[model samples]
Structure formats: structure tokens, C-alpha cells
Target: MTPGTRIEHDAFGPVEVPAERYWGAQTQRALAVFTIGTEYFPPCLLHAFGLQKMAAARANLRCGALDAERADAIERAAAELSRGRFDADFPLTIWQTGSGTQTNMNANEVVANRANELLGQPRGGKSPVHPNDHVNASQSSNDSFPTVMHIAATLEIQQRLLPALAVLRDSLADRTQAFRGVVKIARTHLMDAVPMTVDQAFDAFTRQVDLGMERVAGTLPRLRVLPQGGTAAGTGLNAPPGFDTAFCEELSRLTATAFVPNPSKFEGMGVHDALVEASGALNTLASSLIKMANDLRLLGSGPRCGLGELRIPDDGLTSSIMPGKRNPTIAEVLVQAGLQVMGNHVTVTMANASGNFELNVAKPLLIHNLLQSIRVLADAVRVFALRLVAGLELNHERLAANVENALLAVTVLNPVLGYDRVAAIVREALASNRGPREAAVSLGLISAEDYDRHVDAAAMAAPHGLSALRQEPSGTSGRG
Candidate 1:
């Protein structure tokens, strides 16, 4: 211990704490007990904690339970924490007590110590702003931690993840419109199928993002309900009357997000099912992103011997061994991000299931994994939009050539000609290394003039009425 450090005592006994630190006994104990990973909650969550403390102080003051001076000191201290000035003070790991009681106490101690300082008291002096009596007035770890969980998760989604997804969606929509006329071969089961515009492919990707955004939006209503008033066991015990309503009102005002007291506070405390449901939505988004990124990688596979359809910018990254070789850096980045989020949902679901009795013990890990997925996904989506998807280049000549040489282009003739005849033509085109149109002509299945009109890539791409080369060859009536 440092020479200037002071010893603080709690139920467990005395422990030496650094003199410059704002946290007290409980926080110091937790810091020493959980010497696990360095993965702490982000600043946003800590800010949410500070904001919750501030709202509680205001609510307690408004309800006449707390005096003005103590409330003002706690409120000022909370505002500073909410502004993220004390993020370093919270060095506790994510792998802590299941109910996150230790972290809750960490917040309580920081707020109390800082509040005392605001009143000209020495650091660690919990006089006017007692950690539990004032800073954590009218609340418990069971209630306050869950309340901040919802608030932090909600804001992170609305302000960070959704906007990043919107940018990616817009980028895809732009490409869809820009490439509307560029026709390319469609692939099914990794085999050539038919002709479709490049825009059609991008349009599908845009719809995936749209649906992902909607799924995430669906979780907001449930998240807006808070369990802050139901301290200890959802009974609102020891809390002043009307405190719940006031706390919610003050919280809503402070966050600009409407929050109501949970009618069934027991359910909120007993099960983190709401978070599990939100994780499901995030998982769906990760799946969609992986599919889209994989598609981009396939499209941008090769500028020489592969698809050669789309070009992926390598973000200035080049292969060390093979100079001038650019990999699909952003696509790989999104794929790995998706994998992590997919894994995170499982952890959240399992943790939610492990909650016993009145309080779920998995609170710390739940919020940790949830915020981890959101922040990583948001950053990856933004990078994909601006650095990769928005700058994608199309190989128009390659696309046109692939569409021309497509053997399955004859599949369109199946509607007019019999399937057997079209199959024969497909085989002959592949074997003879001739275009489908030329095969159809040489096989005497259609006249050159009629083949020219019917088998055109663009014409077959969107056919209004069924018509074949040579108008259903004489004596060979269509199956339909």
C-alpha cells in the first residue's frame, strides 16, 4: 500500500485503499476479490449508472425523504460521473457478483465520496452523503442495476447501433439503384441459374438490413419500463410513497427517454428475459450481416479467375507475400464480428436462464455481453458502409460476358419449349462450348431471328408474355 493511502473498514474488515481514489470499502474489496479479466463495462453503462443515481437523488428530494443539501451534493457528483469524468474510478471486472451488487456498491461509494468532496469534506468521508443512506437512497442493487441495464442498452441501440445499420442500408440501397441496369448471371446451389439485374441482388441485401432494424426496434417498448422503485424484492420496501413515479419521471427527463415503473417488478428482477429477447434480435441481425458479407466476398472473389463481378476495397491492406493482392478486409471483419455476436446471444440466453428466486445472478455478464455485441457490431457496420460497401465497383464487362455465356440461359425456353429439348440444348451448349442461343439455332430448335428476340438476357430477365424462338416449333406443342 502507498504511504499516503488510508484504511477503510466494512463488514469484511479493514483494507488499505489508495488516497487519491474516490471509491471506498465495498469497491476496494470487490476489486481485490475479482481478479479476473480486465473487461469492465464501457463508459456508456457507467454514465447510465451515474444518471440513475442523479435521478434517484432528485426523486428522493422531491418526495421529501432527503434534505436539499445532501441531494444537491449527490446530484452534482452524479452529474460528473454521468459526464464520464470518473470512468477510471470504476476498474472492477465484468466477472463479479452475479446480481452486480459489487458494481452497484462501487457506484454508491464513488457518488458518496465525490458528493462529500463537493461539500468541502475530505475524500472517503461519507458524512453528509452516506454511500447507502444518501447516494443509494430509496434503491437497492436488485432494482438500480436492472434499471440502468435497460437504460444503457436502450440508448446504445437507439443512438449507436441503429444509426450505423441505417448507414449500411443506405449504402446498399444506393448500389441497388446504381446497378439496376447491369445484368448478371444468377447462381443457385453454386451453379448457373438465370439472368437478374445487379440491382436485384443489392435490393435483397437492403431488405435484410431493413428487417434487422425493425426487429431491434421491436424491443424498445419493453426496455422503456424500469424496475428502479422495487428495491430489494419488488415490494418497494422502505422507499417513500410516490418514489417510483418520481424516479421514473426524473429519469425520463434526464435521459430524454420515457421510462415507466414496471408493473410486475418481480418478473423484471427474477428474469432477464427482456434482455434475452433483445439478444435474439441482435442474433438475427448478425446472421443477416454474415450472409451479406459472405455474398460480397463471393462477388468480389477475384478480379482475374473468379466471379470478377464486384470489387472489394482492401482498406489499404495488401498481402505481404503476394504484392498487389488485396483481400476483402471489411467483409472478413463483419464476418468475424457476426460470429462474436452470435456467440454472445448464447451467453445471454444461458445467463438469463440461470437466475434463481427473486434476483437474477447473471446481471453483470448479461449487460457485458449485450454491450459488447452492440458496440462491435455498430463499429463494424459503420466501417462496412463507408469503407467498403459504398465504394464497391462493378465489373460491367465481366457481368455481361458471364450472362452471355450462361448455359442455363436456356432455362427460360423451358416455358415455351419442352424441358427435354431445353435440357438437350444445355448439354450441347456446354459440350460444344457454344452459347445457348447458337446451340438453339444449330440444333434447329429455333430460327436465328426468333432466337434473337426471345433469348435476350434483358428480355428473359423480365418477361411479360411467354414466347419462344420460332413460336413453339411446328408439331411440337408446348407442355402448357
Candidate 2:
């Protein structure tokens, strides 16, 4: 079939597709039916598929299934695909295909046909370099799918997600230092409780993100172990004796990733615990992101009506009906993405648990959901930190006003005035609509200047203030 020539096909019913279309009739049909949504198969998984084909070709060569020339052809083709050569051919349409067989065949055919072209053979011609025998030797769809999934996830984490998380961590660190001098009223149950610096709040957020990144890093070692040797079942029945380790070694060398062989073939083929654990790590990160994003939203709530401790940038009009209204749209998107990632984690967990002895048939959905989660989280973390958290401004005046109205002022007055006196003054101040400083002065418990000097917001924002507060006896000197 030459360019601009239409060939009548039995399967496709004479509809004209592109002359260079690599996928077959079934994939084209599925593509037409599943075009209802914008959700397309991500490119990361395709790259992983290409890597898997390359590894399979190496495994075949080591196992004597193909000569060096044929292996070189398949490898060269796979490398081209991995370098993002044949992207347009891999149109995203496997969503409607139940078993993902269409996608598997699509990958096989594309790489094989390309290999044939490179070897100066006719397209789709099975010769010394056959798609199944040379390209897919010693592998089943069951093993190949999950292997590629692991490769995709590991690459995404290392190349994109972890780096984005590091950016977020550094942003929070900078904000922590920037807000170190600003004192704000801390809240519990949405009511004022204690005094803390904005730096402390940002530090807490940074800690959550740091711990989540650590957890993600911890899962990488386990995820690097692959089950390539388990051909169809847990038994390496068709695999050459030493092909397992050699193939893995070759893959590691080719991809520059630590691709190790699975120690126990049974567990590798039977379950997807590695993927489950990876998803769990992602779930941990999602949980942290939800908490941090929600806190940011609440802290930056309103300039006039809410806490107003921090100011987030207003990106757009929040409402169509209301005038001069802005909302935390970035935070909302981060929170929603976190929720979706959590749901994806749950789906992965259930799918992992439901796998039978020899295979986990839920890999298509698992890879789909997991990769989506990773991409959303990586992009969200980057956008949220750069656009919202990094650019946030502390509303120092509002914070001071809230602190003056808070009952926690008694905490500062308890050292100079006894605890009982401070408690009484707090009650009287609340009842008489007077500030704590005024109540202390009216009762002659402390001079107004002395009260101001002792409870200095700037001094109290320091780490030394927390140390001093910790040393003071509980009921004796609540003042630091």
C-alpha cells in the first residue's frame, strides 16, 4: 500500500486509513468507538512498552531464539520508538478493548514492522526477525504488561515526580525562612488556640512533603525487581537456563535503570505486591498533599472575612454571579487531584488482591490508574508550589489582630502575673470586650508597657521562645 492509495480490507470493511498506519483493523475500530473522552494513553507507558520490546529482543538473543543481526534490527527499532519516533502511530484507543490485547498486539506489530523495514524486508514479513519469535520471545502479555508498568512508573518517579517534589520541598523551605518573623494565631477546631509563627506552619507543611518524598524513594528499590523470566506461568518453563539474569542485566544496561531479576518467580508472576506498595507510597503522598493544600486554602481564605493568615494569588473570577470574588482554584484542583489519586490507590489495592495464582489480569486498569495518579500528582505539586505556596504573602496586620482577640494571650501573661490572675483576666477580658493587655492593666496585674514588652510578637516568634515556654512550669508561668 503506497501513500494516497486505498486498499480494500476484509476486516476494516473498505474504510480508508492512513497508508502508514501501523495498527491493524481492530485497533482502528476501537479508536473510533473510544473517542468519547480526552483521557488518552499517556506517552510514558508507550516508552516503557518500547523498552520492554528491546529487553525481550535481548532475552531472545541470549536464549538463542534469534541471531545477532535480527536482534540488532529489533533493538534498533525499539530504540527509535523509545526515542519518541513512532508516536503518531500509537493513537490512544485501547480504552474500549477489554483485554488490552489490541494494545499488546499494536506494540508488537509496530516494533516488528519497523524492525523489518530496518532490515530491508517487506512490511509484516515474518523472516529471521519475527514479531513473536524474536521481538516477544520468552514473554507473555501477562509478564510484559506489568514489567512495562514498573518501568514506566520508576522512570516517571525518578525523572518527573521526585524532582517536582524536591522543588516543592525547596519552595516550602524558602517560605519557611521568609515567614520566620511573622507571628500568627494557631487554630484547633477552627478556633484560635495558641501563638505560632508563619514559619512554623510552613515548616510543618515542608515536613509532610519531605516525609512523603522519602517514602516514595524507599519504594524504588523494591520496584526495581522485575519478573521477566516467568514466561506464562510462575515456572520458567520456556526460558533458557541463564537468560533470566542476563536479560535483566542487559535491560539495566540499556535503560540505565536498576532492572533486577525477581528472586522468587512464583511471587513475581502470581501477585503485584510491588505495584501495590508503589501505589501505597503514592497514596501517602496524596494524603500529605491533601492536608497541605487544604491548610493553604484555609489559611489564605479571605482578606476580610476569614483567618487571612496567608494570601494566595487570585488567578480568576471565582463565581459568575458574584462581583469582585476570587477563590483558591489551584488549591481546589490540587485537593481534587489528590482525592482522585487516593481513589486510584484503592482500585490498585483491590486489583492486586484479586489476582489469581499465575497472573494478575487487572494490569491494564492498574497501569492506567497508577500512571494517571503519578502524572496528576507531579504536575499538581509543581503548579501548586510555584503558583500558590511560593508566592504567598503573610497578612501580618490580620494575624496580629486575631492574636489580640484570642484567649491564648493568657499564655504570655501567666509568668509575670500568676496563672490564677491571668485566667481571671482572660475571663474578664472576654466578658467586658477588652483586650488581655487592657484587662491586665485595669487590674494593676502588670503595667501596659511591661505587658507589651513581655509579650512581644517578634520575640515570641523565635525558636528561643518555644524553648523558654517549654521550660516554664505548666500552671505557674504560662508566659514565655
Candidate 3:
């Protein structure tokens, strides 16, 4: 053996594992060959692996597949692993195996070794608690890895993503109430269209975020269906009868989350359609977030030269060359994060579709991208809510100015002056560089009193007498 390495034997031959590391022969071999990427599985996934191992051990003990003493040692070691005690022992990157077999084995070996150490045995000695026979009892990398994927995804979405989104939604709802009376010019096709309150725009964003929460929640049912007892190509070949249901029940008790055995373990291991469906939901959310972020960028465009409808919260971020230049840094960051999530959706979609007969060869990549999407998007949303939406201010002066000068408010005058007459008024207003009211007054179109009575910009934002005017036959339809 090498100076600092200890000999561990697998089916292939003797291998030298680092003496200080708890991983065994297979992990050492994987570390040597799969030198590819820097992207390791997230801590949440590792924690999920430990949880799965612990649950499996409990089930195996109940099924009489493991002795009570070994099971006790495994439960202790795995519980510690789940709490992040053995994080350093799991160093394999996501690029190693498609089914995450290497990572699964890595977890097994670590738990076994740790359990042995706790039972007065040396590390790397598979005695009293063989990694596969005990720690991985009634499980295969195929079923267990996918189950871990589901557990990790569900926990992250439930515990992290939804709460962060709710924070943003509540902030937006508060803004909605705050801006209810502040009317502004609305735009369509990048042109001034009519009047709308600032609260209306904020309310629309609140609805989008609410629906995003709903969409993310919609994916949980499918994710909670676990494929754990389908050992070796979804056959349940080596797993004891009733192991699937018992394992899920134990996992649910451990995590306080509802999980059930998949009805068809073959489909669960073979296709990964549930993950694809989840990616679709996330893609929709990304699109909504992008829309909201870009709108913030546009609405808060400039204090002098651009729209200037909304004022962004200044966080001390400024351009290097331009003094006193406060950019919409939070909006920009949010948009970039949303774009990355959208891109991750594409990778997930393709990876899911590439699955072959018995198992998808894209498990590691799919979970990596999905979990990354959840993490970054959740953090960005929290930042957006705290640093941007919570501190957002309306540019009241600009909003009033734009609403006062809006030409499309003349649509409210259509019943008083027919569409053709109103069209001429619009053209004349533009040609003569005059306000619509002024243009109508110059043309002897109507008395200024009537113009003021009919053209209240704030009232035009909601239902007024316009519909009644259009319906009443006694309406003034004059061209003279």
C-alpha cells in the first residue's frame, strides 16, 4: 500500500483508498477516472441521500433483512450524515455517472464505514455493516437515486422556493394597496394607450407571482411519488415485498413530508416524465419572472431621459464612468437569474427525452440543473422583494405629467364626438403640437367646460359614463 493510502478490495481487485477518507474502493476508483467538472451535488441532495439511507436501514430492520445492532449503528451514522457531519467525505462531482450510481455508492460506503467505526470496528472494514448488504438493503442506485432526487427537489421547493415567492408576493400586494389612487399613463405596443393606476400594474404582478406559486405547487404530487423499491432495472428483483410502501412511510415520518410509492416503478425509473413536467412548470415561472423584471427595468428606466414612471431602490450600485448614475441593479440581477433558469429548463427537457429502455442516463445532470434553478431563482426573488419591491417608489410627478398629456384619453370622448371626428382631432393634435383639449378647443369642437367634464384622466382608468354614453341615443355626436 502507498504511504498514506489503505488497501480496500472490491470485486475488481485491491484498491488504495485514502486512509483519512471514509469512502471505499469504488469511490476511490471513480475519483481517479471521472475528472471532469467542478459542479458537485448540492448539500441538500447529499442530505437527502443520508436520509434515504437511514430510512432504508429502518425498513430493512423491520423486514428482518438486517440485525438490530447494525441497524442501530447505521441509523446513528446516517442521521449524522443527514445533518451534514460527513459532507467532506462526499467529493464526487455530478459528471461521474448518469444514474448517480457513484454518488449512491459513495453514500453507502461512507455510512457503512462510519457505522463500523461506531460499532468498535476500523474504517473501511465492511464487517458487521456491509455497505451494500445493510446500508443499501432493498435498494439499487437506479431506484434510490431517483428517490433522492425527488426528496431533494420537493424539500427545496417546499421549504425554500415557495416561502421566498410568498415574501415577494406579499410585498407586491402591499404596493398594490399603496398605489391604488395614483393614476398613470398606460402603454401598449410601446405607445401611450390610455390611463391606468400604478396599483393596477402592481396587482398584475401580484397575480403572476401567485400563479407562479400555484404552478410550483402543482409539481409536488408527481415529485412525491418515489421509486425506491425498484431494485435493478425497476424489477423489484432483490427488494423484499412491501419494502416500497414501508420505505416511503418511514421517509415521510423522518422528513415530515408526504411520500408514496410510485404505482409503476418501471415507468418511474425508465422515463423521468415527472421531472420533465416539473421543468415545464419552472419554465413558465421563469418566463413570468423575466416579464416582471423587464417591466421594472422599463418602468424605472431613467430619472430624466427615459420612462421614469417608477423609481428603483438605490443600493449604491452605480456606473463607474457616470457619477450619480443609479442603475436598476436588482431588476438586472433578477432578469439574469430568470434567464439562467429558462436555459436550465431546456437542458432538463432534452436530458429527460434522452432516456433509454430501463433507466434514464441523465439523472445527475437533470437534478443538478433543477436544484440549481431552484436555489438561484429563490435567492434572486428574495433579493428582488427585499432590495427592490419593498423599497420601490412611484415617480408621482412623472406619472401625473404623462397622464395629463396622454392623447388616447380621447377614446373616452368617442361617444360625444364620433370615431371619425375623434380620429381627426388626434391627427390635428399631433400636427399642431397642441394638447388634445387645446386642439379640440381651437377647432371649435366643444366647449372647454364639456372637455374637462368628459376627459377626466383618472376616471377614464375605470368604468365611467362612457358605456352609458355609447348606448344612449341622445348622446352628442357632433362634427360641427
C-alpha root-mean-square deviation, each candidate: 1.9, 4.0, 1.5
TM for every model, in the order presented, reads 0.96, 0.87, 0.97
Q: By the lDDT metric, which is better: model 2 or model 3?
A: 3
Best by TM-score: 3
- Cα lDDT tens digits, model 3, 1-480, are 789988888889999999999999999999999998899999999999989998998888888888899989999999999999989999899997789999999999999999999999998779988988889988999999999999999999999999999999999999999899799888899899978889989999999999999999999999999999998898899888889988999999999999999989999998788888887888899889999999988999988899988898899878899998999888888889889999999999998887889899899999999999999989999999999999989899999888878888888878787788788879999999889999888877777988888888777777553546433235455734
lDDT of each residue in 148-250, candidate 1, tens digit only: 9999999999999999999999999998988887888889999898887888899999999999999998998898888888899999998999998999999
In order, what lDDT does every prediction score?
A: 0.89, 0.77, 0.90
Instruction: Please give the lDDT score for candidate 3.
Output: 0.90
User: What is candidate 2's TM-score against the reference?
Assistant: 0.87
- lDDT for each residue of candidate 2 in 34-72, tens digit (9 for 90 to 100): 785555568888888888888878877877877899888
Report the Cα lDDT for residue 140, model 2: 66
**Could you tell me the TM-score of candidate 3?**
0.97
Clashing pairs in 3: none
Ranking by TM-score: 3, 1, 2
Best by lDDT: 3
Candidate 3 deviant stretches above 4 angstroms: 463-465, 469-475
Instruction: State how far residue 69 of model 2 sits from its true place (Å).
Output: 2.0
Q: Least lDDT summed over 10 consecutive residues: which range in candidate 2?
A: 5-14
